[model samples]
Target chain A: MRIGIYGFGSIGRLVAREAVKRGWEIVGAIDIDEKIIGKDIGEILGFEEKYGVVVSRDVEELIDADVVVHATSSYLDKVYDQILSLVRLGIDTVSTCETLSYPYYRYPVLARKLNEEALRYGVTVLGTGINPGFLLDTLPIVLTAPFNIVEKIVAKRSLDASKRRKSFVEKIGIGMDPEEYMKALREGKLTGHVGYAESVYLIADAAGIHLDKVEERQEPIIADKDMIIGEFKVRKGEVIGIKGYGTGYKNRKEIIRLEFHAYLGAKEYEEIMVIGTDYEVRWRSTGTPGDQGTVAVVLNIANIINDLSPGLLLMTDIIPFKPFFKH
Target chain B: MRIGIYGFGSIGRLVAREAVKRGWEIVGAIDIDEKIIGKDIGEILGFEEKYGVVVSRDVEELIDADVVVHATSSYLDKVYDQILSLVRLGIDTVSTCETLSYPYYRYPVLARKLNEEALRYGVTVLGTGINPGFLLDTLPIVLTAPFNIVEKIVAKRSLDASKRRKSFVEKIGIGMDPEEYMKALREGKLTGHVGYAESVYLIADAAGIHLDKVEERQEPIIADKDMIIGEFKVRKGEVIGIKGYGTGYKNRKEIIRLEFHAYLGAKEYEEIMVIGTDYEVRWRSTGTPGDQGTVAVVLNIANIINDLSPGLLLMTDIIPFKPFFKH
Candidate 1:
């Protein structure tokens, strides 16, 4: 099958290399960076420059491909309009945009517009990736499949932030004053990316629940010692990280609480749980070096695109969500 | 304390007797039945007459007591106006009406108006009962306190239908046609009660989650079997029960799903779960005879009213939610 990478960012390049390794043709590449435009795809990805395909900034040039992989920026509210424009032109698309996985929860109008446009063009749109997609959607479905009597579902994703990028570290308010970080969060300026709410919606939709309410909350980090990262210095007892969570209720009663935590210098763990009348099942895995688990979960759904129906699909709907590596 | 019983129903009589047992003076009782209007409270309750206070149909007379236990009809919307009128008179009030527990979820405007009036008068108004009050609200909170790091919360309550009342059996279509039952549910004519949604909301509030969406769903009975109770013959394959659930979401993701189940002639079980990083805790209790668990939960809360805050409260917010009876 022929494929196109819609943005030449780190994730886009990684997906491109993976697709090529799987015998799919990298027919076209798109990137707005002048430094990489017209350059060989392999060179931009730090691979030995062997593939003859070159990157271009032209959207029209890449629109003709069989499939498009959208590993672009995380600011979905700004890029979704353009993406929907491409979707309207009959392109099957998969995105890593944080908000796209369950856009209906946050951007319902945009989600519906994209769905309608995709249907008009006879294409499909899906959002899939690490946290919201895997832990929230896929893993819960997989863990619950063994039981015939499923009662409740819960998911938790925890990460240590010491090895993360500087941009992420700074945005999470690590090395900043505690009060200032809280102020920024209250103003919605320093809050984490939006998708945890979408994850709850996706899972509830899958489970046939008409939820009454979904709530979000965050807890600030309290550091006991000063820490430094790059040029920034964080004081003792300053806010260094956040733990974000969402809850699903049936008839105004709590049935599930899905938690996502990211920290600057902390321990790591991710778990998905299903509670039933006679049994309880759980799946947990520690974060690997460089967050490879995230990449594995995103790519695991690539081979099953044909089975997915039209409209917006989250990771739980697309993949078997079982222990892929174990299988 | 002087207490008056409004409505000569089963719950009203029981509460009055319980109050008498606690040494509180029964000022009088009120009901619409003309035959019982002039009768003594003990005589109406099938006990030898002792308390000289006679039953009256007058609402003004009922409101004259220091406290009014409003255990009137179950249809709250029809009687809310009168209840509010009583609240406006500054009388401390408690009701057995299920809808009053989370009035905001069902009738937001009325709940707000009643709360405003109660606040203005500095008089406490509470909606209390077994299912919505204790099972959904108080149970989940008490289960989570031992855990150091809570990642998820789920509560489930299930009961056998054989021991339920005629009203519950008929409402769930135990002896009726499936088509009619489903139609009634879809039209919102067969809503079992209103507090399940409120229970989830109260739990989320206590857990410190500000959910964006709370969804509710119902599961109709689809099994094939005949259930016979007294002279009533419930046909095979008819809905003998219903399951109601709610979930709360944050950041577009699900964090909790709360469930309540009522069965007229089935097996019985109730469970509460708390999923955390180091421990997963679950509390399970079997249903008592004649739907007595519900009565137990309600009476248990009533037994601790003096220690409880005077204002309205959810199950999780109450102190006695922990294991009240050690087996």
Candidate 2:
């Protein structure tokens, strides 16, 4: 299979390496960054061996590829035109866009438009990643299959912001005081975090719960002691991170609750607890690299893109992803 | 939807209740038991409300129903004629037969024949339950979606036979001495317990692992102290239950391991652990009622029977089941 790597950033590079491992030809890379444009893709991703593939700013170069592994942006609006162009060119796509995870609930018009375009071009478009797609929604829903009656779902994801990329740390309002964080929130610079509400909404939809209300609350994780993370130092009492919760309610009872925390000293682990009529299930993982998981889900979904029907699809709408390396 | 029920045993009655709850009409039931032949199913199942349905001995009585929930026997051969009759009558079926979970691996001819019959009649036939279908294979495969490279999978299901029905306890050779159990095994009255090897093969198939050899070993779980389970009693050094392991290997390396134990004092829990290149994950359920889980999975699959294509299908071949209750 010939594949294109869109948005040659961290996740894009990850997908490219996986594609190569699958013996797929990396036809081209699309990125607008001037510094990396025209550079050997392997070198840009810190590989000493040259792959003979260079990053290109021209999207037209990807037209010949069978599919594109898109890791461009979390917001569907930003990458809408690019995704449409790929579908129109008859290239299937598997993206890591958060909003596209279940866009119909939040972006009905865009979701419908994408589905129509995908059907028109006879291609499949999917949005998937570790968080919005897997960890919080699809995984938990799948876990509950063995139980007869599932009454409630609770999922918690805790990540140490200091261990994450600088962009991710800043995005979560780390190192920001109450006033500064509020300013960013009001200015719309710090918009919706990826998985909080999406997870709750998707779970509600899957369990057939007509959620009467969805609620979100965010609070700062204040530093109790001085901490230093790669030349970024924070004094005691300063905000080191953020903790957010999203809950979906049915008939005034909270049926889906998601807790997320990313902080300098956050205990790093992920867990999901499900309460059923006959049994309760819990899933946990420690030392799971966030970036690797996000990239892995995208690559896994890419392998099955052709097996799905044409449309804007959610992770649950497709067949469950199997291990890609089926040997 | 009008539904006919076959087997009219524990799982059959369970499916009837679920179907009724879904507002499906119980048109008729087919069972060989003379005692319940003309009895109202609701009364036999301990319900005060009359369902206006009676059990019949004739398989022809099931022709008018939209589907049949068959839970008669564990072995596919024992239930083959019955299943074929249902398919010939143009009634779709969801069965609890273990070998039927992935019959192609062990019964190629029968599997093909069933598929042809199902197609000829434009109906679908599926075998699914908590054990062979969900907990051991599909659940673990679905859990590995976030990992890029999965090296191994280990699942452990420990059940306390004392907590289960008498039929389940006797099926596991509980309270049987070595000589008695061996005689039963040789007589074919005590066949292999369901789900262990079938789970391994299904997981191997779903993960794309071609096993060079699949191994199974069963040993006695002896009672160290006197234990009483209802009216059944076991003395010290007597066989309390059974412990079985099914392992699938590729290139002489173990890729899937399933350990099952059902003994008097066994700790009750279900867990699946996966070793991935980046990280490992664990899923656990405490005090999970096996009977309840089995009944739930069958009912869940029944809801989606028409959503799938016509065939003698394995659990992995169809879409993963979802929570079916819409209210």
lDDT of 1 by residue, B199-247 (tens): 7777676656677898988867755767675455667787767878888
Q: What is the TM-score of chain B in candidate 1?
A: 0.84
* lDDT over C-alpha atoms for residue A169 of model 1: 72
Which of the numbered candidates is closest to the native, going by highest lDDT? Answer: 2
Residue by residue across B98-119, what tens digits does model 2's lDDT show?
8899898778899999999999
Tens digit of per-residue lDDT, candidate 1, span A195-244: 67777777777665778899988868777788774355667888768888
**What lDDT tens digits, residue by residue, belong to model 2 across residues A1-327?**
788988998789888876676567999899999999989998987787988888998888898788898888888888999899889889899898888888877788999999999999999998888888888888877766655566788988888778887777778777777677877867868753676777887787666566889998887778788889765699877778888898988777887889888888677878888787545767676645677778777777776677778888887676432111000
Candidate 2 CAPRI classification by DockQ: acceptable
DockQ for every prediction shown = 0.01, 0.35
Task: Give candidate 1 misplaced runs (Cα > 4 Å).
Answer: A228-233, A288-291, A319-327, B1-327
Looking at candidate 1 chain B, the ten consecutive residues that score lowest on lDDT are: B318-327
Clashes of 1: 73
lDDT of each structure? 0.64, 0.79
